[model samples]
Target: MAFTGRDKKWLKGPRAVALLAAGAAVVLGLATGGTVTQAAPAKPKPTHMQVQLLALNDFHGNLAPNPATSSSGNVNGTPAGGAEFLATKLEQLRAAAKAQGQETATVAAGDLIGASPLLSAAFHDEPTIEAMNEMGLDATSVGNHEFDEGYKELLRMQKGGCLDDGDGQNNQNSCPDPKSRFKGADFDYLSANVFYENTEKTLLAPYTVKKFKDGQKVAFIGMTLENTPNIVTKSGVEGLAFKDEVDTANALVPKLRKEGIEAIVVLLHEGGLPADPRAFNSCPGISGPITDIAKNLDPAIDTIISGHTHQAYNCSINDPAGKPRLVTSASSFGKIVTEVRLSIDLATKDVDRLNTLANNHIVTRDVPKDRQLTELITKYQKLVAPIESKVIGHITTPTVVRTADDAGESPLGNLIADAQLADTSTVTNGKTPVVAFMNPGGIRSDLVATGGAVTFGSAFTVQPFNNYLVSMDMTGTQIKALLEQQFSGVNQAANKVLQVAGITYTYNPAAAPGSKVVAGSIKIAGQPLVDGTTYRIVTNNFLSDGGDGFPAFTTATDKFFGGLDIDAFASYLSAHDPYTPGPTDRISITS
Candidate 1:
């Protein structure tokens, strides 16, 4: 079953015999002094093919290099990640593979755009799309963030065009280049699990088959996490139903096999975490949704490239038949690239699973930058320069950061919640919101005290979703149900504890999910929350629409849409100059 170059002659026996016969015929014709013609022998079949798969995930439209202190950090103390450097690294990888007669493909697991930084977000992620196209990405899965602007916008991102109804006066020119209308993604975006609710058909292509020069084919099936709708803005996924990831991938396996594509790879938007956070290349004590999904995958699948948790790990998980299958992920923000080498046996037309090798490579900054990518970054940087450097506010202490505690309470989260509460306190309807809740996911980054001053870009980076505040009325019982829901159902795995303002409660982690929160412990403004009484609540529109698995918010009454979350946060910071960290006593965790 193992193939080495020396055994290639056995697989090419028939072709060699045909070539020998042709040579004998030519010799006989020359001996007779008569012109004779014979058909040329067919090209010899390769005994094996080597394919290099270069993958990254959760890029999040970081066209420029992120600061070492931020999301893009040193891998073993080496500064890493910049699109220019990433392009260079990818080219180097492909060149090395080519020298050994191998083919290379650049792919992604998803979140290439949306929730992006100011540079790329300014033009609605057109720049990021262009950057990927330039870098020669072959395909990518659709992450939840890809649905942030709704399916129609996602279609635009794929098909190429400008936003017809641009985002306010500020975004009048949605397309970055006026000389050319936006050209859509050169790479294919796969989404096997997402289907239109009415038609029951896939919204996009389920999978894509890539063929090598020697006719060896590999199919890539892409899908996001099954609970995508729960985390994304409800309106974005209103007409779509996200099916189970494993079921979707399994269903496609037979179809691909029927097409004679024995090599299958899954580009999934869900990922796992390893025991040691620093071990990027080794999988030790790996655990998460991806672990279970990988183990249950059909034996036909050769590899699983994943993302979404934004952690890096290269694991060899066994499939259902107990065959080892490679599963890998690259850290987020273009910080790393996962290079997977798959050996395909031409004889069986399937992957030589035993010979596959995978590892995570850092996109170190020491490499020379790609000049084109550098120019692209410079173009976007100049466009966002005005708003990127404006001084907005100040952080008095470094501890006023986004790092959450055991109960998921963070100084920045508390501050953001308080800002939303204050913004909705005096609405035109005369109904005031007494409590505010911020989803931990919505807090993208920490408010690092750089020289004690925070820029407009820094504030925007912390709250980049462009979410609007929505105030509503919920009963104390519903509020309690929401708190309890955080530790159960779809959320139980991640345990996304909501950040609270003007509310406090203790929860026991050892208790059952439904009974985690201590009864009679919930209080707001020194008063015990009465089960029958109603309280005004304010949260981002995503949460109000029951995002993050908080279904209780869907039943809220008297909903009122307020200002943008970032604006409220900025106004709050402006009012409280030199802000200090708040007490983390809001949500206490009990064992």
Candidate 2:
């Protein structure tokens, strides 16, 4: 028997199928019907809202395109990155999101300025700060480089003020426009972990709560590595305390929840390395401090935007609750932007973590340039031309590059270390230096020599820190300990192998952590290093003060301050008129 109209209304949904199989004829309302009934499909109800987070990190103020042939200028074989192109790409991304009815926020993970090219650095990175404001950066974390000049200068970058030192302190100009002076960043600089010890308060705002049209709030908590003091100049973060990333973020979750906010984001300045280096969108075997930090983060945090390693990758890391969460980093220097589309649960006001998707888009130069950024770059170029155009020296074919080889040594890194050694050796900085060790991270860019002629601009771009030289005396044993640091301690997860001159050694990376260096393989000018022998070492003040986790450097004796690093580099280039690439044989890896 078939069911009648009234019977159909009493039937269940998909659950009705079970009733039908149980025996339909048992109670057919005492009448035979002509047809059987089927359930109509249920209409879908919206459960989430799309929010667009356009992120860029480690944009070390490349206001103009790097030299065409330089690695920094290219991304994945495409001529990419320049402030104009980056601005246009961001505009397109924001416009696309707007067309789709998505709420959008532009954010960065840090290193937005400092170590910039001549155009931006000449004005104390004010142009880059202006550019970031123009591009609409909503907020950013403070990277190690943000403290390059000192926390006071960083505050000035965020709060707008002219340097009291005026125009000539470090070959940089004061505010170009005296009338307007300098307008600080329109974006918020979140520094959750950086606090002034004496005051017991953050140096900047700890986090920013972004409120959208519907009143749904998203909290972005930002912080740099706890090891900041070890990486930045001691003078920069003198009274600031850097807290642990996970602990700091986790502590904020309860506070955010107290305010009924559930969707949370972290703009962390720490980063990781991907096993598959070439793929920006895929993170295979991603490992580093960020991984460990993500693993222990509070489950309430929905996303993590990381930087500092300057490598690109889109990844999904598991939170404390074992739920997959989105993690991303765009390669540095404004070369790429990681577009993250997060779905917020409308009912709960929390992120639908599973519904998130991220992509790292290259800032390809094919698109039309943003006029405003172009004008900014042009104005700065004109201001810096007089001094930047001065020819410093010449370089042979195949200019020295900063790209570290398999052994973690770069031709430019070697050149810089040698230059530092040469400077102190002749000038006699109280202690005559026999060895110079340069921190690889300090070698920012390639010394691109067009027509074999090196200009002050090109040289400055490679070493913009203006870090002065320090000559010190270290026992041979202390020197060995410093080399071991390349693969141990905070560096164990990611290497910071020093670039050296007047030294040769083979390291066995596969060996035990502290025993990577081969026995008796070390030599300084073809002589074995004696444990008790004292040797003079020259390095930039950053390294000499243990800036990169080499505590051994801090243990050295009789520090003698010398000229600026750039001065040594420029003078070396001039003295060596036609600088040639080294044999590049100083470092080696054991089989």
Candidate 3:
């Protein structure tokens, strides 16, 4: 089993390297008569590689601490999310690895930008990009949200385009100009499967080869969900098409193999395992697209870093070849960072030992904030501080936001729907404003009255996406159909709703199928809701695109942009007194 110089050379690639390394270890074992000679057991093969990797995803531009629940649904953590803390952590980890004489790499699985907090989104992800640059990310995959501003905007971020003239339009300096400080991103982007429809070739490099000082080679392929087009706004990715992740990897592996590259990793803009719902500490029970992709990936891929669902976990699964495949994900909003250590056989260059070291650490005041990166964040934070604190309105009562179990609507959801409805009606020439509905998933956080001061920033923290308020007139029959979408059933069980502004309905899960709505509870302003009558409604553009399967909104007539929903919500709160709903009657799906 001993490997000759020629054997080691042949096993240089990542795939065959592991086998060769194993073969050499076997030979060494036999030669030593199953026992190692003196000399401290020859220092044994390293259980981990000298390379340390830190990965994160789904930050959602939460430049401030976000209120997140524990996986186990108990206890509250400290104020833990911000660019300063994230940078601090990344630097600390990198410094530790460097002290150990190992190379460190920081990367993201995407969602590094869009649908961000008021500070980042308002600037069209420039601030987020600046933050990521300071954080030292090496590369990332293009997540669905990256398409929020359309392909041109994506190109702008990638190629360093700007609005140097201080105008928002793409008038001048759209791509690259000689005078601007826009040097583009310090890292690269991978898009193995995404392609231009008109051209079959990949729109971005399928993979990037990273070489370490030890002559070890690692190739990374980045991919987003294959259904990105369906999930994001259509115009955002007009000329692009996404291909299957596994297929793309399979096709690219041979090329890497031919080039003598062995170690391969996937930076997938997908996700896995929820953090312990019972405890906020660690992740458990792997799930989602990443699991499926890992299970089906070619054996050549050694590890997968995933995001999107915003949960954190460290585990390994079996690939199609029956070899162990490692996968890890960090929780969303900079709440956690995953460190994956891979050990490869030096002689054969194949992965032998791989393990996940940590997850779900609070990025709090405890960590030593990196002064350099903190300065960068501080500059932008100061620039947006005034706008973020500008008061929008106030709520007398606490507004709760809950999407646990993906069940019924939350009070915050109701606020968002009302905002959309109010805004839409106010803008349209003669549109009726009967009622509005917001999906619970759209409401990101709860707002406490806390002395009755609410700001524009706080409102954005509730509904941050740039989704325009949309209005439509739907028949009562359509409303009933929308209710059915949230009904649990054998085939369609994942259903939940958010509260509405003016519309009210009751759901009785105990009732027979198709009869869950209470007989007389469906109403609008004390009127018996006629099944055939049309009523004006408001919702976000995401729901209008049939997100979360609320297809009824898509069928409604008279759709138009009603401006920012948060503004309307602010106006509604200003006009109303105290703003308290009757009860938690938004949804009660009984057992």
TM agreement with the true structure for every prediction:
0.70, 0.71, 0.68
Best by lDDT: 2
Query: What are the lDDT scores of the predictions, listed in order?
Result: 0.79, 0.80, 0.64
**Poorly placed runs, candidate 3 (over 4 Å):** 1-49, 67-79, 164-180, 274-284, 353-364, 385-415, 422-435, 439-498, 501-518, 523-591
Q: Is candidate 1 or candidate 2 better by TM-score?
A: 2
Candidate 2 on 1-591: residue-level lDDT in tens? 244554453332111110111113211111111122342221112877888899999888788887656667887688889999999999998887787688899999988987666677767889999999999999999997788778999999999989755554345786866667888899998899888986769999989999986788999998887887755546677788888889888998999999999999999999998876666655656788988998899988988999998888766666777666778899888988888777788899998764565667889999999999989888877778756877888998657888888899888988898899999522343457889999998887899888889988889888876666778889999989999999998899998989999999999989988889898988998899888999998898778767778888989987765656887898899999899887678989986
How many angstroms is residue 467 displaced in model 1 relative to the true structure, after the best TM-score fit?
10
Q: How does model 1 score by TM-score?
A: 0.70
Could you tell me which 10 consecutive residues in candidate 2 have the lowest summed lDDT? Answer: 14-23
Which of the two, 1 or 3, has more lDDT? Answer: 1
Please estimate how well model 1 matches the true structure, expressed as its whole-model Cα lDDT: 0.79
Give the number of the best model, judged by TM-score: 2
Candidate with the larger TM-score of 1 and 3? 1
Supply every candidate's count of residue pairs whose N, Cα or C atoms clash at under 3 angstroms. Answer: 0, 0, 14
Q: Using TM-score as the measure, what is the rank order of every candidate, best first?
A: 2, 1, 3
Worst lDDT run of 10 residues, candidate 1, spans 14-23
